[model samples]
Target: MAIDPKELRRCLGHFTTGVTVITCQGEDGTPHGATVNAFTAVSLEPPLVLVSLDRRSRLCGLLEARAFTVNVLESAQKDLALHFAGRPNQEVRWAADSACGAPRLDGTLAHISCTPWQAYDGGDHVLYVGEVQQFHIHEGRPLLFHSGQFHHLGGDHNPLLWDDSADGPDAGVSFISTLAGTRRV
Candidate 1:
């Protein structure tokens, strides 16, 4: 009747997720953050997002007090991810989000600023649903986390593959031309 924690973690590791570092500033004016993989787009209608944090983490208190920013790291930013996730002995620098005052890492692929919408108790972790007030996208492939490691996407050694089932060559060309607006020479 009981489930094994190791097995549960191993099973969940099979599901790949984009890595992000969620950050906020504490009341004492200190920045706090943690490497998080439990973030996702909740809804488009209201522009919502969700990030789960362990109740005991220092970042949880900051998130409870003020707004937060989710900095989605690109594949090139794997060091940033690992740095934030590393031991407390390592020093990390964080810049404040100009719009919301939350802490954010520089040169992220994308940043989403949000106000806390609602919080629900999820066992040891609390799920904080946020209403995205502002966001910005940049050009880069996302850093993927799976099987207890960070994976780089879309490189010479690891190229992106389109799902063939989605369309044929003609459809692909049309889609690219429509998106790009023209062909070069």
Candidate 2:
């Protein structure tokens, strides 16, 4: 089916995601980063993570068999995000270069360092898998994005929402329907 790109983007944007800056060194040994939200934890046994980059992105070209860092942005780091996303900011805070030789931004919520694990063609994008080497989590609220805008947490964290709910994903569809007072026809 021929899908409208705009419509597809809109639909996809409904899903909220955390913002991150994928950092790596250029061929000249200079630090570089790209603002990306297309990142996820892929596995546990071998500690893998994934980031999808546009095929045309300079960072995509630089990631082949390279080491990189994923800097998870906190709510106050929107300007940093904008900077890596191609909008120049007056200043960016750079942490000490990571073990992987990639620069990390200071004041981020988390930093995940990785070495190139695998790569796959993802149509307009390239899926890059990284074998996690090190990770650090800091205390801060994550920067979130949805529907073309940035968002903050509502400060409502219900730890029991899933653990104590019969309608949770672990309960199966029937339990969800029952909890909602609905039934299949």
Candidate 1 per-residue C-alpha lDDT over 87-168 given as tens digits, one digit per residue, 9 for 90 to 100: 5554565555647677777788999988889988988898999888888889988999999999976556644344334355
Return the lDDT, model 1, position 59: 77
Q: TM-score of every model?
A: 0.79, 0.85
**Residue 181's lDDT in candidate 1:** 50
User: lDDT of model 1 at residue 92?
Assistant: 62
- Model 2 misplaced stretches (Cα beyond 4 Å): 156-185
Error of 2 at 10 (Å): 0.7
User: lDDT at 25 for candidate 1?
Assistant: 79
* lDDT values, one for every candidate: 0.80, 0.88
Tell me the TM-score of model 2.
Answer: 0.85
State each candidate's clash count. Answer: 0, 0
Model 1 local distance difference test score? 0.80
Q: Per-residue lDDT tens digits of candidate 2, residues 19-127?
A: 9999998899888899999999999779999999999999999998889999999998888888999999858788998887778888899999999999999999999
